[model samples]
Target: MLEVQSSLDKFKKTTGYWDFMEIGIAAIMIPFFAYQAYRLPSILSKFGAILIAIWLTCVIYTALKLKKAKPHEGDSYIDYLRQCMEYLERHKILSRKLMLWYVFPCLIGVAMIVVGQLDLLDKSWEQIIDTRMVWITLLIFMAIVVFAHQTNKLVVKKEFTPRLKKVGELIRSMEEDQVES
Candidate 1:
């Protein structure tokens, strides 16, 4: 039980740190993305900035959502563990849904920027779009998306999933012990 609590404490701290880092980076980049819209006179640039803004908004929203799962200190042992499990479950759900709420908007925003750049070069679609450059760019970004998704999945599988199971088992056994008493 002490070990489980220690593990949960670590998980909470790590989650809080991650949230802080993500929000901090987003805060810094918000101005940069806003400047991109203002600096680039292209419609695509403005729209791309909007999409990126949406992605950041989603990030903040999700972080806030995760923050709401805080465990109260005064709760009973089994109850506290249950709350910890709830927090981990929330993280698991959010991590699983990153493709919808996290990656897709950013991908579209980046694609818009690439298209805008190609257009600015005054190259026809066939000249630029058909070349190895565009294909390589697409492939690279796709690879990154896959890598990120798989990494998050692995984290949930390795870190959160086992912890969740252990917490659940702890709660169950504690309950059984109580009933036996």
Candidate 2:
């Protein structure tokens, strides 16, 4: 019984740790990308706008799907935590797909920065800064951040909330059982 209690405590701690980490990551990304947007609005182009729109569509779809999901059954607190962790793992995989979408723009942005710094291109400062290439890359990066935020929110809703709910239910059930006994 003591061992079971210890395991439950460990699971609770692990879940809390991951929850904090996710929140921290999301919080950092928001401010970082906001700075990026302000610093490089000129880089945003028509193609990038389309990409952002598509990314937003995916985010909304994923959120709706997760919001509609039903919680799984569990026999113990550890079981519930394990189930939630599995859900989070699935979300991690989905996040990789979103990351893939940003790869092209990221590479292009890096190349542009490097080439601009090295003076490999003969473009003027205004042309380099105001080019469609730069804005599109910025747009892609911003869109990725937005998509990540949405995915993180879904993970919190599907994993943390449900696990917390299960833990509460378990505590209530245990109290009732003890009272009856």
Best candidate, lDDT: 1
lDDT of 2 by residue, 1-181 (tens): 3443454455546645744564455455545544544454344432333344344444445544643342355686555545544554454465456455434544444544444443435678887686776667568767867777687668666654654555555556666787999
Error of 1 at 33 (Å): 0.4
Instruction: Flag regions of model 2 displaced more than 4 Å.
Output: 1-125
Whole-model alpha-carbon lDDT for candidate 1: 0.83
- What TM-score fits each model? 0.91, 0.35
- Put down candidate 1 lDDT per residue, 74-105, tens digits, no spaces: 55777778788888888888888878878888
Which candidate has the highest TM-score of all? 1
Residue 154 in candidate 1, Cα distance off native in Å: 1.0
Pairs in steric clash, model 1: none
